[model samples]
Target: MLAALILLSVGIIEIQAGGTPICPTITTPDWGEVSCSNENNVGSRCNLSCQAYFDLVGTTGDAIETSCGFDGMWSTATEFECVPIKCFPEQVSPENGEVICSANNFAQSVCVFFCKEHFDMVGLSAANNAHAICKDDGDGDEIGQWVSSDGSTDFQHPFPPQCQPIRCPTTMEAPLNGQVICSNRDYSGSYCVLFCRDGFKFANRKEKIVFSSCSKEDGHDSVGEWSMPDAPSCRQCTRAEEVQLVALIHESEGDRGQYQVATSMIAKVLTILRRRHGINPTLRVNRYSSSVDASNEVFTTAFTLKSSKREIDAIPYPGKGANTTTALRYMDQRLTGDRSAKIAFIFTNELRDFDAEMEMKARNLVEREVSLFVFTLPQKNRARTWIREQLVKITRDDTRVYALPRMRFTNKYKDEVAAKINDITMTKGCDFLI
Candidate 1:
């Protein structure tokens, strides 16, 4: 019976190993095994083993036992993952440094001192522990200085030095009204003593004039003193005691003629003379009438009597026989032996042959007693050579023959002509000849 029991036991065991059995097979729990009691027999137990867990082993070939306890504690199976140590700032610019932590939980420093072109490392050397600073190369003093929070250095100064302001001399002073002291730059001052020229008088000499310094504030120098108070007087007009004279202007032609151009020119001359020399003179105009039998003779006699003081006449169209003869004879009789009277004769329009005769006769009649002045109109057909020669001869000796250009009739030219005549007559002493 014992032998049979043994055999039965062996079979039962093999069936259990085959994973199926009528009765539970009991065995000791090994690695990767789960222990559980059989359901059919309360006292019978079984061991459940997984191949994957049983294959794991330690370095000594011992099984790696793992257990899940009711307390919820798990046995260590693999090591905790060893993450790499890192730094807050992963990288830094050259000439700068960084701090890092090691896998062993240790801190370390790293400095990059070398910089790129156009930059220089300042401060201390960049090593494992020391901080590093850098700057740009520059020319001015105080170079390599930080300019902004962004780690930039100034290459130049903000402001540069400049030249000083110029100083004006203090020795200069202002001059009086008629006189002024001119500075080096031609600035005048009232404090400067002044003197007037022979004809000039002091207009204002009371207040002292002061000139400000030459600077950007003051633009330029002032013109010096003058003779007049408001305006400096450089010259004054001097009146002469002389006899008044008359000028006859003829506007139309007749038995007694009209001299329009001559009259207009003479009026301008008189105006200039009055302004320049303070002289007042008389002027008259008479028209000719054929009804008057002796019109030529009457006009001649009237002109002579009127112009006796000045002995000047303006004869229009002297070529006309009656006018030429009448004027010559009247001038001869009235101007003769009158050394004080100055005669000025103006021939208007175009000159004729008889003009020469009249000129010669007048010259012979008055001699040095008369000063003749002729105004010839600009014309294409000028006087004959004989008449021109005689006129020139008379003008050279005692007359002024101004041959007005064609342009003299215009307003602009009239002013110029009047100015020229006034200048000549006033500057060059002349008898009161109208």
Candidate 2:
């Protein structure tokens, strides 16, 4: 026990003399040497010296000596890194190419090359290796440099890598009121499409490609060429030339049963005119019953009827034959100074009165160049014949009278109705003509 106590006391005294933990392990760096005064314990001093072509960094006290302190730390910063001397070759780049590098010297440092606009790199496996790295000579005695080619022995390859300009198919400028967007500005296989601004519509391409492509050449062609259909024009109609359509919807009690049909027909006509053709026309709806008189304008600049119910609800149906002649007179007054062709679509189930005065009014319509078309849903076969006769008497044209069959409001019937209206409007309306 006395001997053990003596040994422990000696150890304590040795630790107190140092008063710090054991110094960290030290070793000579590659291409360099280290010298020590007292070794790795506390109060030990270490100094670094590099071989011929290397330089030391992070050193102190004449930039070399570093001593372990009582706090178990080096007097200078740890990791006294030694770096190789820098050597740069005549920096060169390929024609039309630029170079970038992380470092100008030392092994593992790399230089990258890139081609200018309209050009692409060639001769190397770009998918795998597109840059050059600094490496050492086989004997580790000579400094190496980045070169253009793997087999080159010079500092840089005598002939640099090539960059070839890319050529694409030719393209025309964008059309009026339209924009063209391309995948590649002028390159083979580039694609482009046309877009027109609001209020203008692309015309004449009902069943043809509107987008263009820089297509690969056929065997007959010398080079790849642009492939495109005849481009369509963005079409817009002038305000004065717009067609004027006035639908005089009959709201007499007798025609109330056909309200759904009339509503559907009017809505479909307006939709085709405004939505499909982009024609904004003045629309005056004459909802007349001799008892309750209402003239509701459904559309002037825009059409707002979304459904058949909305339109029917907007028409007040509490009158008796407010007189089709009266409605025509109203439209005639509206068309006083306007020289544009007008269409007066009259929707009715029966005609209350057909007199000499009505005939004169009808003749006035023809004189004013106002086209009249009559769409009727008569009650009986005899009544249908009479209504047709009356339409001919009023408009003086048998073709202008269309006696609709008594049927439910089905899609097939609606489609047939829409087709009939479309045919008439396209053929008769001046704005629909080319």
Candidate 3:
């Protein structure tokens, strides 16, 4: 009887458990159906009994539930999405500043409000998502500036205007022969004149008065005319009365003395006589060299005159000391008798006792009527004053004694000496005999 009662009670308890609610169930269309009996539950199941036993004994509520799809899955209908951040360009610090972004960067569509030329960016480029900013240093014309994209700076002023130098025009007119020159900076017009040779007059004198102003009619572009008649023909003296010139050159070995001056004087005298009367006088240039021996080279060198019609000769006298004395004696004899033969003596260095010999000769042969001119060259180490005194004593009170300083013998002083000779000859006339 006890076994029968135990089995029956067990059977009754099992049948009641099948029909009783052990836990709440969840159902879904995709997951089919699920029971929370603890036999096939996905996770901790929700049931009224479990809830009441934990702490909700008096709570009149449905079973507590837990999710069962996936470990981190949530309903897509209830999920909210996160939005992406965006960046934009800000205003440029300097509005006048220009900007030059990279071509690729620009095409990517980034705002460039703060971008500028020769400036640095303060914000993001197209490659980044940050607000962009730009700062312009300034253009080249500014006090402190930078270069542009082309590596050039703004000019403070336009490039200075280029200018060309002025050039004077070249002339081709004859006589003027392009010798015309501009006088000043006023070269815009014709400003040149023509000149003619001395003694020859210009046909265009009125028009060519100054080189600074020339006209086309004045032969500035063509050969001009001569104002004066053809140059006077150089004539030769045929009569003795026209004029007369005689040169006595005394040369010695190792002593050039004033031979050049004597020759020059003779030339001047002849030129003057010719110009005055349009008559070239008969010239007699005689050279007397002391070293006139068979072996002396100077004996063969004859004195020459520029004129082909004039007579020029060199008389060589032998014996150094005696030749000079003999030449002077011959000159005195010739001049004393022949009134036509004008004479002048150029003495070289005074040899031993030569001065005494000359003084004696002067006293004996030289008369007051004979015009004799003497030029004495001072000897080195010899006083010029003493020589001048000696010359005065020999020539007496005559103006024939001319003592020229040695410095006058140089080539540089040749012109001055020639001028002096001309003055002397012009005033005295060729009739003075010297």
Candidate 4:
């Protein structure tokens, strides 16, 4: 939109940037047209006006003044050229978006930016719905730059913004005794659904399923995240049934002081369950260790709930490492079908040989309809932390992991533990009965 002027010489010789006066040839700046008025003589004037979209090379004002004198030479002279106005020409539009610009990219043009669906414009450039005005970077070269302008954008093509996938909070975790599935391809309009396993239900009015979707937050133009506050949880089916308790009590030289409590808890769990499962001669108890150095490694004979106390009492101390993979594999061979409600309890200080293989076996045990509970003696270390992580993978349900407040159990806790196990085998709790 801007225009400029240049003063030419009126004389026998045509005016040019560097050429000296010649008899017949004329030279003029390529930036614009030069006017020669009818005669070539002293005092006549030659005029120059820059081409469209080009500004005068140097000096301001409507015109720069100079004249042709009787000496037949240029009176005043300087070197310069006309340049096209623009912001950065190499600019790329935001990904997954398009833009419209005004003025054919010449001076004073503005540009507007728009992103495709499932994407949100990000960065400060999105402040005004993303508009940019053609301008210079504030240096004299005027190579061109787009600057954020008076208000929100729609004005195109300079200082373009970026389009990014929208998002919801990634903080939501799978609930206890249940699983969560989410489809968050671009987070825009994405959703998450929760599923409770068989024999388990949500405590919130006994809901079987729960879910929520992600949406753009009001007043926000970019990626955002939302989370379920105090997230819902899954509780076990409260029903009374026969419980077959299969426990693996780990024994090691340094027991973390769990040898006594682990054994006592098992004996109590069996007693609490004696009324329903003690009579089943097919169900038995045993002590197993993957380490050859461990005592009583083999599980054998008819040891019912009544007779298993002696077996429980004899649990070896300073025995050795507990390889749970072997224990789960051992149980997998014996339990099947719907004859009774089966429960597997594993007691340990910290895990040993508990790897992906062990987790897979534990999951297989759970899928076969067996309730698996892991009792770990509370302590600290990288091993303990690792055990905590692996336990979630094995159980899928963190509720199944029980961390003791102390190395030893009190009579009150022992009874409470027994009662918790007993309660799991009953069917009346979902009805809200005590």
Best by lDDT: 4
In angstroms, give how far residue 151 of model 1 lies from its true place.
99
**RMSD to the hidden true structure, all candidates:** 28.8, 19.0, 30.7, 13.2
Over 323-410, each residue of candidate 4 has an lDDT whose tens digit, in order, gives 7788788777666546456667777666757787888898888778777777776453434533577887776777777776363553
List per-prediction Cα lDDT, in the order shown.
Answer: 0.34, 0.58, 0.35, 0.59
Decide which is better by lDDT, 1 or 3.
Answer: 3
- Model 1 scores what on Cα lDDT? 0.34
Per-residue lDDT of model 2, residues 1-434, tens digit only: 01111134324212333244445556677776777788766889987766654556544222377898765556765465566745356345778788766665666566777766555566533323456666544333334545444534452322335665544445644657777788886565567787665434566543212677665432312234566634567665233354566776664365445766666666666676556655555665656544224345554546666643375556666565447678777667665434454667777776767678878898898777677777775353344323457778777777767665454433334445344444444433323323
Query: Candidate 2: which pairs clash?
Result: 289-319, 289-320, 290-320
Q: Estimate the TM-score of every prediction.
A: 0.30, 0.38, 0.30, 0.39
Considering lDDT, where higher is better, how would the candidates rank from best to worst?
A: 4, 2, 3, 1
For residues 213-272, what per-residue lDDT tens digits would candidate 1 score against the true structure? 332232221123222223233332122233123232212234222244455455555555
Instruction: Please state the error at residue 200 of candidate 4 in Å.
Output: 2.9
List clashing residue pairs in candidate 3: 98-117, 191-212, 192-211, 193-211, 237-280
Candidate 2's C-alpha lDDT?
0.58
Candidate 3 per-residue lDDT over residues 141-178, each given as its tens digit:
11122222222344232111111222234432335322
Q: Please tell me which predicted candidate would have the highest TM-score against the true structure.
A: 4
Which portions of model 1 show Cα errors greater than 4 Å? 1-240, 243-259, 284-325, 332-341, 354-359, 365-368, 378-387, 394-399, 405-434
Better model by lDDT: candidate 1 vs candidate 4:
4
